[model samples]
Target: MRRPDAQAREILALAVPALGALVVEPLFLLTDTAIVGALGTDSLAGLGLASAVLSTLVGLFVVLAYGTTASVARRLGAGDRAGAIGVGLDGTWLALVAGLVVAAVGAASAPTVATVFGAAPGATDEAAVYLGISFLGIPAMLVVLAATGVLRGLQDTRTPLVVATVGFTCNALLSYLLTHGPGPLPGLGIAGSAWGTVVAQLLMATWLVALVVRGAQRYAVPLRPHARGIRLAAVAGVPLLLRTVTLRVALLVTTWVAAGTGGESLAAHQVVFTVWTFGAFALDALAIAAQALTGRNLGAGDAAGARRTTRRMVRWGIGGGVVFGVLLAAGSPWLPALFSDDGTVRAAVTAGLLVVGLTAPLAGYVFVLDGVLIGAGDGRYLAVAGLWALLGYLPLVAVVPLAGLTGTTGLVALWVAFAGGFMAARALTLGLRERSGRWLVLGSD
Candidate 1:
C-alpha cells in the first residue's frame, strides 16, 4: 500500500516536469507565428504551411523517443548502465541518419510540398522559401527528439525540462532579433524566421548530444553506434510507427468529416480539437511516466512491482481524468464562448466539450495502458490493436455526416462518434489486454 503510494509520488515527479517540457514545443511554434505574422500576410501564411509540413514529419518519428526510452530504461533496470547508454547512442545515430534523409528530401521538394499543401497563390513562393530554409534544421530537431528520449529513459526528465525551456527562450529571442534586424542582423523576412528557428534547433540538439555524450562517458559506454543495436531498435520501432500511422489516419478522417460539415463546423472543430490536444498531451505525461517506471520494474524482474506500479498509474489516470471531465463539463457552456461570440459556433463547441468531458476519463484509460504496454515492448500487439480501434471508429466517422446532423446539433453528433465512440473503442482494446496481463514482458532483450 505504502509502496504503491511511493510509486505514485515517483510517477508524479516524472509527470510534472514532462508536462512542462511538453508544452514548450507548442509555445515555440506560437512564438514563431507571432514573430513571423508581423513580416507580412504572405510570410505568415508561408510559416503556417512550412510548420504543418515540419510537424507531420516530426510526429512520425516520435517513435524514436518512445523506442529509446523503453530500451534505455529496461537496460538500466537490468543493471546494465553501460548497455543502456550504448542503446541510446544508437538511437541518436538513427535520429541523425533519419533526420539527414528528411532534410535532403524536404530541401529538394519544398516547392512541391507547398503546392501539394495548397498554399494560397500569394503565399506559394514564400512558403517554398520558408520551407526550404526550415529544412536546414530537421536533423537537429530529430536529434533533439531522440536525445530527449534517451534522457527520459535515464529517469531524468528535469534535464529535458531545462533544455526545452532554455531552447524555447533562445528561439524566441533569436526569432525577434532576426525578424526585427535591429542591429547588424539583416531581417531576411520569412527566410530569417526559418533561419532563426534552425539556429535554436541546432543549439538544442548540440546541448542534448553533449548531455548524452557525457552520460556515455560516465557509464563507460562507447559513443559509437552498434550495428546489431540499431537493427534491434528499428525492428522495435516499426510497430510503433504503424501505430502512429493509424492514429494519424483517425485524426485526418475526423477532420475530413468536420470539414464536410461546412466552415462553421470546421471552425468549431478546430477550437474543440485544440482543447482536446491540450488534454491529451497532459494525460500523456502519465503515459510517459508509466513507460519508464514499468519498463524499469519489469527489467529488474519485479513483475509484481511492475504490476503494482501500473495499477497505481491507472488509478492516477482515472482520478485525473474524472477531475478533468468534471471541470470540462461544468465549463462547457462558457468555454466555447472564449473562442467565439457566435451563438451557433459556441453551441457546437459547447456540445463537443461536453462529449469530451464524458470521454476524457476513457482517454486516460487508453493512454496509460498504452504506455504500460509500450514499456513492456509489446509493440506488435499495440500496432494491431490500434488498427482495430481505427477500424471500429472509421464507420462512425463516415456516419456522422450521413446521419444528416448539421449545425451545433450536427457537431454534437460528429463528436459523439469521434470522441465518445472512438475513445471507447480504444478503451475496450486496452482494457482487454490489461486484464489478460500478458503485456508483462519479463525483462530486457
Candidate 2:
C-alpha cells in the first residue's frame, strides 16, 4: 500500500497538468473575445450569442471525456491495457458520430438560435455567420474531448496540457491574422475568427486522434468500432449527460434570476459569477485527479485504496477551498474595480464575493466527491442527486425575485441563494453518497 504522502504526490501529478489543460478553453474564449470585440459591438455581441450556443452544444457532450476517462482508467487498472485502448477507441468513435450530428443540427439552427438569443438584427446576422462557421468544428471539438479523456484515463495529463497550449497559441495567432488580416491578406472579418477557431480545432483534433490511434496500434487493439462497445459506451454516458444537463439548468436558472433583479444587480451578479467560475477551475483540477485515481484504484479491485485516495483528495479539496476562499474574500474590495468602475456595481460585487468566499470550502468538498463517484461509474446516482440539488435551489432562488430584492441587496440575496443555498444542497447530497460506501463497487463495469 502507498503511504499518504505518496498518494498525495500521485494526486498532484495529475491535478497540476489537468489545471493547465482546463484553462485553455477559457483562454480560447478570451482571445476570441479580445480580437472580435475590435470589429464592433455587433461582432462582439454576435460572438457572445454564438459562443453561448457553441458552448452548450459542446458542453453537453463532455461525458465523452468524463465517461471515457472513467471507463479507460478502470480497464487500465485491471491490467488490461489493450482492452482500455479498445474502449477508448469506442469512445472516440462515439464522439465523432455525436459531434457530426450536433454540428449538423447547429448549422441548421444557427439563425434560429441567434434570433432566440434576442440580439439586435446586425448582431444576429453576425452571430449566424459565426455560428454557421463554428459548427464546422464541433466534430473536431468532441474528438478532442474524447481523446483527452483517453489520455487522462491513461494517467497522461501532460500530453493534453501540451496540446491545449499549442492549440490556444495557434487560435490566438490565427484569430488575429484572419480577423484583422496582415500585409496582403484581406481580413474576412468575423468569418476569419470563426475559421481560425475551426482550423485550430481541426489541428488539435487531428493530433489527438493520431496519438490515440498510435496507442491502439501499439496494444494491437482493432481500430474499427464494435457496435456492442459503442452501445455500452452510449449507455454509460447517458446518466452523466443527465447529470451535466441538470447542472447546466441550475446555472442558467441562477443567471435568469439574476437578470430579473435589475440592471445593477445583474451586472454585479455577472462579475461575481465570473469570479466563482474562475475559482472553480482550480477546485475542478483536484476533482479531475480524484476521478482518475479513484477509477484506477477501484478497477484493480482495491476498494481500500480507493477509499484512502478519496480521503486524501477530500482533504486537498478542503485545503484548496480555504486558500481560494481567503484570496477571494481578501480581493473582493479591489476585485470589482478590475471588472467595473461603478460604485454600486463594485459594492454589490464585493458583497457577493464575500459570500462566495464563505462557500468555497463547501464547493471544494462537493466538487471532489462528485469526481470520485464519477470515477466509480456511479453516474445514475449523480444524475438523481443533481435533480435533488436543483429542486432544493429553485425555491430559494424564486424568493429573491418574489420578494423584489434590488440593488446590492438583491445581488447579495441572489448569491446567498446560489453560493449558499444551491451549493449547500450539492454538498449534502454528495456527502451522503460518499459516506454510503455504495460507490466503492470494484471492477471495470
Candidate 3:
C-alpha cells in the first residue's frame, strides 16, 4: 500500500478527537440546561449562575494544563523524553495542590460568591448547594485537566477524548435519572446535577491515572516524584498561571456585570456565550494541532516548516469557523429552544445568533494563532496579550448600557470586541517574532 502523507495523517490525529471532545463539552452543558430548565426559570437561572462562577474558577487552574502541555511539547521536541515525563508528573502534583486550595475557598465562599452574582433570593440557596457539592470534586477535575494536557503534549488527543466521552456520558445519564427522579431514583433537583459532574470527575480521574501507570513503560523516564524539580517548574509555570487567572477573573467580572442587568439578560448571555464557546472549542483543536506541529518543528530546528505549518493551520481554523458559523446561524431559532422554553429567552438568543454567526469566523483566527504562540513556547506573550484583552472589557461594559443594548446585542458586541482586538494584537506580536526568527534559536530544553 502507498504510504499516507505525513501532514494529512498529522491533521487527522489531532483534529478528530479534539473536535469530538470540544463538541461533547457543549452537549453536556446543554443537557444540564435542558434538564434544569424543565424544573422552572428559577432553577435554570440558578444553574446558569452556578456555572458562570464554576467555569471562571476552573479556568484559573486550566492554566496548569495549558502550561504543562506547552512545556511537555517542548521537551518532546528536544528529544528529552525523560524530561517530558517529569514535567507531566510535576504538573499532576501542582494541579492536585491547587485544586485543594480552590476546594477550600469555594466551599467557604460559595454563598458569598453566589450572592455577588446577584442570584435571585431563591436561586442563591440552590446555587450555593450546587457550588458546594461541585467544589468537593475539584481535585479530581484538576487531575483530569492535567492528564489531558500531558496527553496532548505527547500528541495523543484521542485518549483524552475517549476518557472525556465516557465521563460526560455517565454524567448525563446519572444527572437525568437523579434530577427527574425516574423510577426508584429520588429527585435531588439542582444538587443532583452537581453530583453527576462530581461522580464523573472521579471516574475520569481514576481512569487517567490507571492509563498513565500502564503506559509508563513506553516513556524514556519513569513517572516518579521530583521534589527538587518543583522550584524550576514553579518558576516556569508561575507567569502562565497568573495570566490564566487574570483572564478568568475578567470573564467572571463580565458575567457579574451581565447579572446586574437582569435575570433574563443573564440567561440570554449564558446561552449565547455557551454557543459561542462551542465554536471556540472546535477551532481550538486545530490550535492544539498547530502547537504540537510548531513546537516539534522548532525543536527540530525547522523554522520554515513551523511557519508553513502555522499558515496551513490558520486557513483550516478559519474554514472550520465559517462552516460552523453558517450552521449556527441557520439553526439560530432552534438552538435556544434546546436550553429554555421561555419565549423571551428564545427571542433573545435568536436575535444574538446573527452576530455570533458573523463573528465566529473572525474569532477562529484568534484560536489558531493562540495555538501557534503556545506551541512556540511563547507563554509570556500570551499572558501580555490576555492582559491587553482584559483592559478592553471595561470600555465594552460602559458602552453596552449607554447604547441601550441590554441583552444579547450587548453580549455579542462585547465578544466581537474581545476576539477581534486580541487577535490583532496577537497577530502583530507573533508576526514580528516569526519574522525575527528568534523562536528558532531558542533551545527547547
Candidate 4:
C-alpha cells in the first residue's frame, strides 16, 4: 500500500476498537444511572456524587496507562518487541501498587469525601456504602487500563474492545441480578451496583491477562515480574503521574465547586458531564488513533507523516464533536428525564445541556491535541499548559456566581473558559513544537 493508504488503514484498525472501548466506559455510568434511577432521585444523586469523587481520585493514576501507551509505542516503533512487553509487565506491577494505595485511602476516607461533596444528610450513608465497596475494584480497573494501553501502543485495539464488551455484558447482568434481587441473590441496592462494577472490572483484568499469557496474538505481551523493570518504568512514569494527579485534583475542585452550588446543580452538572463524556470518548477514539499513528510515524522518522496524522485526527475529532453536540442539543429536553424523574432535576439538566452543546466542539480539539502531545512524549508541556488554563478556570468559577450569573449560564461559562484556554495553549505548544521540529527530532533520536 502507498504510505498514506497504509497510515489510514492502520488508524482505522486501531480507531474502531478504541471507539468500542471508549463507548463501553460510559455504559458503566449509564447502567448505574438506569438502575439507581429506579430507586429514587436521592439514590441517583448519591451515586453521582460518589462516582464523581471516586473517579477524580482514581483518575489521578491514569498516567500509568497514558504514559505506558506512548512509551511502549515508541519502543515498538523502534522494533523492540521484548522491550514493549517488558514495559507492559512493569506497568501492571505499578498499577497493583497504586491501586492498593488508592483503595486503602478510599475505603478509609469514603465518608469524609462524600460529606465534602455536600451529600444530602440521608444520602450520605448510601454514598459511603457505595464508595467503600467500589474501592475494592481499583486494582482490577487499573490493570485493565494498563493492559489496554499496552495493546493500543502496539496498534492492537480489537482485543481491548472484545475484552471490554465481555466485561460490560457481565456488569449489566450482575447489576440486574444483584441490584434487583433476582433468583437466589438478595437485593443489595446501591452497594449491589458497586459490586457489579467491581466484578466486571475483575473480569476484564483477568481476560487481558489470559490473552497475554496464552499468546493469543502477536501483540499480546507476556507478563513477567521484573523488579528492575518496574523501577525503571516508575522513574519514566513519575512526570506523567504528577501531571495526571494535578489534572484530577483540578477536576475534583471543579466538582466540589459544582456540588457546593446545590444538589440540583450537581445533578445537572453530572448530566451535562455525562453527555459530554460520551462525546469526548468518541473523539478520544480519534485521539488514541492519533497517539498511535503519531508515535509510529515519529518512530519511523517520518515527520511529515506525523504532522499529517495529527491534522487528520483533529479534523475527525472536531467533526465527531459537532455531530454529538448537535444531537445533544436536539435531545436536551428529553435526555435529562432519562437520568431523573424529578421536575427540578430535569430543568437543571436542560440548562446544563445547552452549555455543553455550545462548547463540545472546542472541547474535542482539546482532547485531540492532548493525545498528539502525549504521543510525542511532550508531557512537560501538558503540565505547564494545564497550570496556565487553571489560572483562567479558578477565577471564572469563583466570579461567575458572584457576578450574578446563575444556573446553567454560569456553569457553561466556566466550561467555555476551560475549553478555550486549554485548547489555545495546546495549539500554541503543538505549533511551536512542530515549527521547531523539536518533537520530530526527539522522536528520531
lDDT of 3 by residue, 1-445 (tens): 9885788689779878888877776677778888888888788888888887777666666766676777777777778766776777787777777789889998898888889867578888888888888899999989888878778788888988899899989999988887888898679999888888899999998998777656565664566667655556566677677667656666666666666556776788788777777677778889878777777677666778787887778788778889988998899979889989888878777866777787677667777877777777777766776676667556755665667666656666554554455445545655666566665544464
Q: For each candidate, give its TM-score against the true structure.
A: 0.97, 0.98, 0.85, 0.85
Q: Where does candidate 4 have its weakest 10-residue lDDT segment?
A: 417-426
Q: Residue 64 in candidate 1 has what lDDT?
A: 93
Off by over 4 Å in 2: 1-4
Better of 1 and 4 by lDDT: 1
Model 2, residue 193: C-alpha shift (Å) = 0.3
Residue-by-residue lDDT tens digits, candidate 2, 1-445: 8565777788989999999988887999999999999999999999999998888877789889999999999999999999888999999999998889988998998888889977699999999999999998999999999999999999999999999999999999999999999879789999999999999999999999999999999988999989999999999999999999988998999899889988887999999989899889999998888888889999999999999999988988988899999999999889899988889899999999999999999899989999999999999999999999999999999998899888888888889998889889988989999999999988976
**What are the lDDT figures for the candidates, one per model?**
0.87, 0.92, 0.75, 0.75
RMSD, each candidate, Å? Answer: 1.7, 1.7, 3.7, 3.8
Global Cα lDDT for candidate 4: 0.75
**Residue lDDT tens for model 4, 58-166:** 5666677777787777777777766666677787788878788888998898888778867677688778888899899988988888878778877889989888889
Judge candidate 4 at residue 349 and give its lDDT.
Answer: 82
- For model 1, residues 1-445, the per-residue Cα lDDT tens digits are 3454666679988999999998888998899899989988988888887887888888889999998998888988999888888989998899898889999999999899889877587688888998898898999999998899998888889899999999999989888887879698678787877888899999999999999999889978887787887787888899999998988889888888888787788899999999998888889999999888877888888889988988888988877888888999999988988999888888889888988898888888888999988888889988999899999998877787888766777777788887788888888888899889898777766
lDDT over C-alpha atoms for residue 430 of model 3? 54
**How close to the true structure is residue 331 of candidate 1, measured as C-alpha lDDT?**
95
